[model samples]
Target: MGLTAGVLAIDAGNSKTDVAVVAPDGTVLATARGEGFRPPAVGLDTAMAALAATVARALAAAGAPAVAHVSACLANADLPVEEQQLTEALETRGTTVEVRNDTFAVLRAGVTEPRGVAVVCGAGINCVGMHPDGRTARFPALGRISGDWGGGWALAEEALWYAARAQDGRGAPTALARALPAHFGLPDMPALIEALHLRRVPSSRRHELTPVLFATAADGDPVARAIVDRQADEVVTMATVALTRLGLLDERTPVLLGGSVLAAGHPRLVDRVRALLADRAPRAVPRIVTAAPVLGAALLGLDRLAAPPESHHRLRAHFGT
Candidate 1:
């Protein structure tokens, strides 16, 4: 087994996993991608096997048996206990390990420092905040039961609800009834509903409707627009709450936006988020985090190591941030 003073950095989201081996000098020696991390869906051992396989590939490519640290930003590690459990699960003989919510990866990937609030809207929505002093604020992010409301899947489901209701005379009229069905090459909402219910159209295909909803809204459909607006509201609401908890709302703090939905930068939603943030958290500096989140995992490891400023700069450069 080879030895190296480096970090095995991982960003494991609900959809996919990314691993990187970074040397102490901040050069990324290797990287690997694999299946998503979902311990709650698959058992813990199964999930670990998938992630460990990816990590092993990266380590082998980097010519290291292991590094001094394993920094994992994982999806579904919502609570501190979950993070601690994952840290212990990932621990190796010669390495220290830490695990944090995936949103924190988006946060650190955008910020120059360890302090910021980040709102991520992908398959689901989540928020997280951190201070340089190690204080953190986060949410349960356990879907509706956890009081969460925005995400691609949720948006698609909402659009379906509104469209179904509009078709059945149970709700106000909206173009979603037409646009949504048309997107799937169906004649109308009833046909779309039948197909979805019977699995003629895979349920996973529902995510495609999110963009259709946005397009309908852009065409001046009030119902669709309201849904989009509500999503923007949720994003800002979460960000504002996080910032306030971290005492950053009163200061000029960075609020990072990440994930597929936010990264798309839909003009209406983006504009609304900016306007709301301006009003509710006037000093909050909002920006989109487009960098690969594995950089943030690596940065967190370097932060633990007390690596120099130049190392951080070099790492950012490697990730093109």
Candidate 2:
């Protein structure tokens, strides 16, 4: 029999790392998950070790003899320099590895068409695009600095800031004062502040507040509604930037919406963003992404193993199911 071909795919996010082994025919052979890989939080050694452990588990489960190709989609791998470092890191493991920003994998996961935009609002926000003419554009996505907002972390931070200001009589009072404490099992704002100061509540867990913010917004809390509205606007702005840069604003672009924030189905947030995009690019329509990013990473690995046109059908077929 001919040698069995296998690909290793990885999605390293702010809170967790997911790995999968895929057959050449696009079947997911096995999968594994581990802790987060954000360099600022986990350090390079721990991050790489986590990724390796997850991949090894996946390969073992799949009974794959060798990893013919690898693709890693990472949250902080935005800049080319960072991608280079990630590639070197993966190469050290003796695999033919391709590293790219997580947003790129998200876009690939959501779109089979030649040109489209993807926005992800998980721990942080990011947007990317690929045009039919082989052009691509991605936002800096460096959080507040890049004016990229709207994500679990951003919502949580905004909720806490608004709640604290309200407690100090500096901002409008909202349901968040009660909602945040109820959500976290804290008796009062002072207790919540103390817990945060003591690191009793880890940063990743702050994403828990995102739902509370959404709830308050739905309940007619003006401050919460304003925060959600602003976040929606920011997401739209990021998508617009990517579309304009890729010159795809005029096309029937598939705008993929991923991440927990958008997945919550907040009508205000989703409808407002849709309206904003419609105003600028009437062809833009939101596509709900159902495929996991790990699959996207695998598709990227498959892309490296075969020409784009050759793999397009297989990629779409695998994800479409």
TM-score of each model, paired residue for residue:
0.98, 0.90
Q: Score residue 214 of candidate 2 by CA lDDT.
A: 91
Q: Give the TM-score of candidate 2.
A: 0.90
Candidate 2 clashing pairs? none
RMSD of 2: 2.6
Can you write out model 2's per-residue Cα lDDT over 132-247, one digit (the tens) per residue? 66788887788778767778888899999999888879988988888897787888777888888898977657889999899999999999999999998888888888888887
Pairs in clash, predicted candidate 1: none
Model 1 ranges off by over 4 Å = none
lDDT for position 293 in model 2: 82
- Candidate 1 global CA lDDT score: 0.92
- Model number with the top TM-score: 1
RMSD of each: 1.0, 2.6
